[model samples]
Target: MKLLKLTLAVALICLVSCAEKGSRDTAEKETAVTEAPAEKAFKYWTWITADPERTDDSYQEEFAKYKDNGLDAVLINTNTDPELLGRLTPLARKAGLEVHAWLMAMNRPGDSVALQHPDWYAVSREGKSCFDHRPYVDYYQWLCPTRKASRNHVLGLVEGLAKVEGVASVHLDYIRFSDIFLPIGLLPKYDLEQEEELPEFDFCYCDVCVAEFEKIHHKNPREMENPALDIEWKQFRLNKIRAVVNDAYEIAHKHGKILTAAVFPYPEMADHMVRQRWDKWDIDVVLPMIYHNFYNEEIDWIGFATKQGVQDLKYKDTELHTGVYVPEMSPSEIKEAVQLAKENGAKGVSFFDGPALTDDMLQAIKETKEGR
Candidate 1:
């Protein structure tokens, strides 16, 4: 009877222990299942370097730090380097960061390619086929977008970048006309040979572009805008840009990757400065560089302009990301701008991106999220 009692007690204890263990296991799983998703993060892009390791000596180390400090994505200008990207993909994955290829679509050849293919260059208003060295700037040349050769070169480059494994997106920058903002000076530079009486509307009136435009419109822009150019002819110049952007979209979409553009803030600035029709293209995302200081009085106009650009461009459904110069303002002020963008219906904002990312700024992003 004593042995029987002892055996029964041991069996009861084992049953209770098993039940308790099962309960603990269930509680742990429930706790884990209840954890929320990570906070949506801000994206970053670099226009300077093509190599990400050159981006920071320790790529993984820097991303781990950013992860700890809080940043969502990093876009490096590596659209030209598939082999290098091959090595960097594993590094980005290990660090838990999204990688992007930054392409200078129309802005070609800082030195090498332009020097080799001089004929591929755009012809300026003065009819200069090969651009003489500019006064202070280092950028030598840009390929004429209307040319099939130029278009193919850019498309091929993008396709190569698209093949890079682990690239989340391909970012198009300078995907427009030359951002040469001449003062529309009251008078042409005297001593300048054969200056026209009309204001120089800087642009790409390349031979190929002119031919395509004439085929579509049956008129020349110079003659119409010259009072000699009709409103329709002037508008045709803007349409050419849309054609290029749409072409790029087809290629990028076919590959199953998202296409995003870096554009100027206002609709007019986009059209005037770079001929980028932000309100037209159905890109996955559009990032307008609304550097308030650069726009002068247009500072207060940022929110309204962005909202209009988003809606007028028929991109109300598209993701909106504003590019801000982080160093120009205080964190609170930056936070207010982001709030303004969000209130005006932007999905998120991206900083111009060299700032140290102060704790206050992170808090502001946090606040922006909570307020939404």
Candidate 2:
């Protein structure tokens, strides 16, 4: 909404009814010199992930083959190794591809910060001492957003990458709370009652959060007593995390780079799972992970979810890049999914991971440039 307001002000600046292309060329050149990769504005995209510290011989060979297929970009998940980035930057450029640095957010690697600092994990509402993984669905722990050290580390990594040349954007993943949910039926083994009351569907009543809540709202959320019943506080918590990522956008843009994030399929999924307020942020781009096999068996589900994301979050002139699950679907399906996204106002689609990619899928990707 705020963006729409700003857009209206800019619209009034243009009074021309006819083109003055020669005069505008000088201004376009200045903008290009200032805005590097983000200003280029990719049209269609896909990706490939390299193995961790493994030799890149095969990776390079595949990329060489990829050069002819017309991939707009690749998402590389390199934890550190600035030297690897140096090599990768040129390799990707040689193949005529844009690069997005895919870095882990809250889901810290075992040997990474989370293992050394257990304080980073968010505690659940039941007073259980554990990480914020889906209440009963998963086994992993996610970092608490309120903690400055962990949050700083995540942002620092992005800031480091923003300095990399030819890197269009820093693609962030796991940008919010751990996946949290309650399973369908209570297990009889745990002696749980069939009609027993559960707190809220997912997430967090950690001591730190409770203390912070009391300080801010002067009441406990559990007493205000629920997410469905007390939706306001839930949104407040979402805003707290949103502020961190939104702040990261400021850091990126200051360096003339774009801040992009991969979020869940829908707003409900985002709010229920991690309290991510995607609708509010001014992120340069949003790649909603449209992993639909987890939703239903419908073949058309990917396109449907992509549209929902574009409709719900994207603003006019804002880019939407659909995250296609390359390993799970057929080649033709991948191609069709990309096409569906384009038709429904998406700027591009990105493959989730790159190494599992097949040549047939690359062939299908070439068809996306048909009308271009």
Candidate 3:
């Protein structure tokens, strides 16, 4: 009986000790999981205009500076020159930066091939072709997205860039109609007021666009007295832009690349101001140029705009990266802008231009990236 009791006691002790050990192991695993760091998904990007005249060594140095300061990607405007993009791609990749071929999609300022086709240019509501009259800026030589030739020309450029080795995306800039309403702060610079959609600024009333709209809606947009009030007319233009973007997306994917665009602030604002409804388009990423100073808005407006875009894209796979204008911002404001963008659910923040980022601004970005 004593031996049996001793055996039972030993078994009880072993069972309790094993249970305690199992509990301790579970606690250790739980602690480990609790202490494990979350993976960082936020990215940093910058827009840069590439100069063919610059030496490779110079570009290498520039790219290295951007990378060292926490930039992960660069949208390089090579003036739609795929060869230039191809030349710069490897160099940027060598410096640990992802390369994006940035093209001025609809606004082809001095496109040699496009300049040969005047009919492809967008016509204003006042019957002035952007081919010559050019809108508020001389560079606003936007093409009519509804025109097959012009759109194909733009898609061809996208395909050319997509073919470049190691390019992350074919970045389309100026993908919308020429702004019907200029930013409020910029209105003074242009010496004008935009209380209404001025005929001079309203666009794509070209014969092709008119005919296309008439065919679809059985009414001519040009015949409408107040075309701005015509919902179908506005929707037609918006759909035209969306079509171009969707086609570009397909072209990019065909070459195993993604399509990205530098768009206006948000869907509703974009549609109202520029006939662009980016949220409805098929794209991989949309970096909205939420430059608050352009609208005479406060810094916190960046967060507001970022959150708006993020909410609009909640169901989309398209990522939103808030694009900030660094030229007018101080170092402290830069940090605040980055934090606001993060807090508002931006996947990343991109500076307007790489050259505009001062050392202090870069340091601010670096520190913000390091969580310092």
Best by lDDT: 3
User: Which candidate do you rate higher for TM-score, 2 or 3?
Assistant: 3
Clashes of each: 8, 4, 0
Worst 10 residues of 3 by lDDT: 219-228
Cα-based TM-score, every candidate: 0.74, 0.78, 0.91
Superposed by TM-score, candidate 3 places the C-alpha of residue 167 at a distance from the truth, in angstroms, of 0.5
For residue 287, give model 3's deviation from the true position in Å: 0.4
- Model 1 C-alpha lDDT per residue in residues 88-136, reported as the tens digit of each score: 7667667776776778877775635545666566655545543553211
Candidate ranking (lDDT, best to worst) = 3, 2, 1
Candidate number that wins on TM-score, 1 or 3: 3
Error of 2 at 261 (Å): 1.2
RMSD of 1: 10.5
Off by over 4 Å in 2: 1-42, 129-139, 182-201, 222-228, 314-317
lDDT of 2 by residue, 285-309 (tens): 8888776665544557667777777
Model 1, position 239, has a per-residue lDDT of 73
Model 2 TM-score? 0.78
Better of 1 and 3 by lDDT: 3
For residues 1-372, write the lDDT of model 3, one tens digit per residue.
999999999999999999999999999999999999996579999999999999999999999999999999999999988899989999999999999999999999999999999999999989999999988887789999989899999999999999999999999999999999998989999999889988999998998888878888999877888899999899989999999999999999999999999999989999999999999999999999999999999999999999999999999999999999999999999999999999999999999899999999999999999997
Model 3 accuracy (lDDT, Cα): 0.94
Candidate 2 local lDDT, residue 17: 22
